[model samples]
Target: MKKKVQILSILFLGISQVAFSQIKEEKLILDRKREPEVKKIEKKKTSVTAEKNYPPKEKKTQDSLNLKYNITDVPAASDFKTSTIQGEDISPKFNADYQNNYFQLGMGNFGKILADGNISTTLENQIEVGADLHFLSTNGLKKEYNWDSSQSSANIGAYLNAFGEKGKFNINADFGLNDYNYYGIYALTPAADIDLQQKTNRFKVNGYYDFYSNNILNDVRLKSSILTDKFDAKEAQAELLVNLSKHGVEIPMDEVTMNADLGINLETINSEFSLLNDNTSNYFNATLSPKLTFFKGKSYLMVGSGFSFLNGKNNSNLLTEEAKNNKTYWFPKAEVQIAAADEFKFYGGVDGGLKLNSYANLLEENPYLVSDQELRPTETKYKFYFGIRGDVDQSIKYDVSAGFAKMNDILFFKANSLFNNDFSLNRSPYNFANTFSAAYDNGTVSEVKGSIQYFPLANLVLDGELSFAKYNLDNNENIYNKPLVVASLGGKYSLLGKKLNLGAKAIFSTDKTTNSFSFTEAGTTPNVYLETEDKNDKIGGFADLNLSAEYKVHKNFSIFALGNNLLNTNYQTFKGYKVLGAQFLGGVKISF
Candidate 1:
């Protein structure tokens, strides 16, 4: 019995051992299965911790990965509405089959005659040649004054263009002659026997070259001119300009451009009369300008400065003391432009320079200048101006501006005094029977000007301009021969399919007061004093009306007529000068 019991215990113990073994094996298998999951969880926890410490890189968006392009299509003309408010076609209209040469002739009242001719042609090798001639003359009205005037002018020009792989070159030359008479001055002394004739001849030659390069130096220009007048006054001027563009240089702004200008001017005056002496003047100027554009060229600023040197000798018997022989000036130039809106722009600038007052220049504006007058340069210290210009709508535009200028040696017109005239010693110290002498004053001039243009229809245009000025002279003397208020209104219309064109213009000016002098018989001499009552006698304000009409009879022929000073108002532009009254001119133009 003991052996049997022992065997049973052994069996039981063996069974238990087997069951324990199985359990152990299953636990080992389960642990093996869970090992990967445990490691994955631990890895996930680590990844979360790392993510808290550092941010991951962002993924690129689809829109950012793709490029975009903008396209625009021009609208057809038919798409636009047609009405009187539509914008006019301002582009020049040409007859492709028309001829280039033209001639015009006309005659008017007051024994006036007019002739004009022009011819132009293009040759081989890109050469062009042209010539023009004009002549006009008018006899005095049916008044006691014997005013007769004539003008003849001619011009010839040539241009040549040469192109190569490097760049292009342009050469041009021009020659011109002008002849006129100072006839309006006869009203001052109708009985005085005098010859009033003046002539001017001018020649100019210029060349320009553009280099095809990405470098800063891109172009160069050279110009030279010679001008001479009947009074033996001669002038020569030469100019050089170099343009630089920094297009290749990368900048935050849009563009940068620079210009360098160099100029030389020479003038000489010679007279055989003892009252006038020989003189010579020389001037040299250098300027540097640079412009910067920002906001894709919507805004710009240009800064510049110039240096001028003048060397001259004034030899005139009329002056008690000699004028300045040498002078130097530094002038500033600056301008700013901002595009506040799509169609509106704001612009302002400050600029100034020395204006060379030469004998020929003065004579052109006032032909009755006294021959013995001294010539000097006018110094403009500064001119400050600001304005806004923009299109009010599709068919209207406007510009308004205000400016102030400080000037030294501003020239004005004054009647020549009879005190210095000795008929026996000289041929009357005056320029003519009715002569004016240049008077200078230092002052500040302020002006306001505005202009507007409207195109109410496709074939009609209306425009007007108005200006007002005030002068504050350094001395107590009043501003002479200056128009304080000036205004003009004009309109043009095309009828019958543009076959007939009509235009009208009206001009008005405010009265200006100037000191008039009268000679008083004195002992052995004549004394001159300002005439107080007669100051307004001959210097009254006047308004003028003008009309012009043209009818195109054919493609190559047109008839035109012009009427000037229709009001027949006898107003004096100068102290003793009176312009023509009502006059009419009719002419025919032949194009071939």
Candidate 2:
């Protein structure tokens, strides 16, 4: 029993040892698994401490990001105050000064006088109102010259504007009185006592409405006007125009736009003299244009087309076959633009339209026109042009172009032929009347033109333009009154903070040809009669120079002097009428 007990104890001891070894192995495995967790805790604590010392970057505001230079070192302001930031003031500067009223008066050689006044102010409801008056008179160079003229005009206008909105309404009214004499006959009959006086009174009213929205009907406009003039002749015209447009029509890589215009015009004219005829005219026009623009690259092309319908009628005794009927036309519109570089661009286009000539319109362009005249519309079939226009530098710009145009029924002016009859009551060979009659010439005209503008200094600017034209008439008729070459140069300089301003302008024109009429005796002694003969008269070219200077005496007052025709040129814009010579005028301008 003692031997068995010893053996049992040994076995029990072996079993105990094996169990202890297994238990130890399990604990070792658990410790290996927990080692990574202890290292992670230590790393997390180190990360937290580092983050507390140095915070992460915060997102920047839009305003701060837009700044070109760094301003992170700037100190926070303790109190609100006006101060400079980087040599620029960050405060609002308000000026409550208003100067919208002015008056000027002056007199010069040849009994010339000028008076002008203007006043403008802002009213309630965002309304702006203004009025202006002007008066001018000149006794001319000499009594024998018969070039006396005088004019007076006034205008009143108002505008109602919606700020931060999309609408506007405006209206204006004008009245004018002009007086002049028929002095162009002096060259034909030097000693003729010509006392023909001409006077004209004009009245006009114009108004317009514009609105914009965000629908298919994006924009709309309505314009209307009434014009009337009375002289030896009476004329009246009324016009109305309506326009509608749409925008923001998106296409692939482009935007498309469309516009439509409808218009109506009516004119009536009458003459008191029995020689001139009376007439009434009406015109209706409508057009639709669609345009496309691409905005994907440096080069772009705009394609558009205009479909127009024109209807016209005239009730008169002297109406031409074309003018007395209705017509329809089509106009093409297109343009191309390419940006070659940062400061260089190339552009070109083709466009055409119809233009109406009325009695009131003719008189405004040439006041010496005869009352007995025929009116018509000019139709431009096509006008093609190509050019380059861009800035050479920050201080200079240039535009050069070449073009060709085809026109139908273009008008030219020529002196009236002398009547040759002794027994005829209206037969005065030298009637002491110089009348310009309109003549039509169907033709094509080609032209080249260029202009340049330079700013050598901030306060000084110089500009010039030159043009050349060639006309090919279908009927071989002379292109009367049209200059082949024309050029102009002008400059303005300001000194002493614009307290003193100086300006100079010069114009040059090439000679042109016109037809002149003269009377000659014909037949034998017993049967003596007068015959009219035609001669070509060459109007000489001329250069006109004008200068002006103004000095400010006060903030609201200025003294100025002007010199016109400084070269004393004996040039005649008309066939026989000579312009004024050298003259000086001084005046004071007051602003309030």
Best by TM-score: 2
* Residue pairs clashing, model 2: none
* Residue lDDT tens for model 2, 424-502: 3232222433668767778999999887665445445556778999888898556877788987665555566667766
lDDT of 1 by residue, 414-514 (tens): 76544333333233324444566677889999999987765455444556678999988897356777788987665555556667766655666787767
Q: For candidate 2, which ten residues in a row score worst on lDDT?
A: 84-93
Assess every candidate by TM-score. 0.71, 0.74
Error of 1 at 245 (Å): 3.9
Q: What is the lDDT of residue 457 in candidate 2?
A: 51
Candidate 2 local accuracy as lDDT? 0.54
> Evaluated with lDDT, which candidate comes out highest?
1
Model 1 misplacement above 4 A:
1-99, 142-144, 147-180, 184-194, 203-231, 247-250, 253-280, 290-297, 317-327, 422-433, 523-538
Query: Looking at candidate 1, what is the lDDT of residue 97?
Result: 21
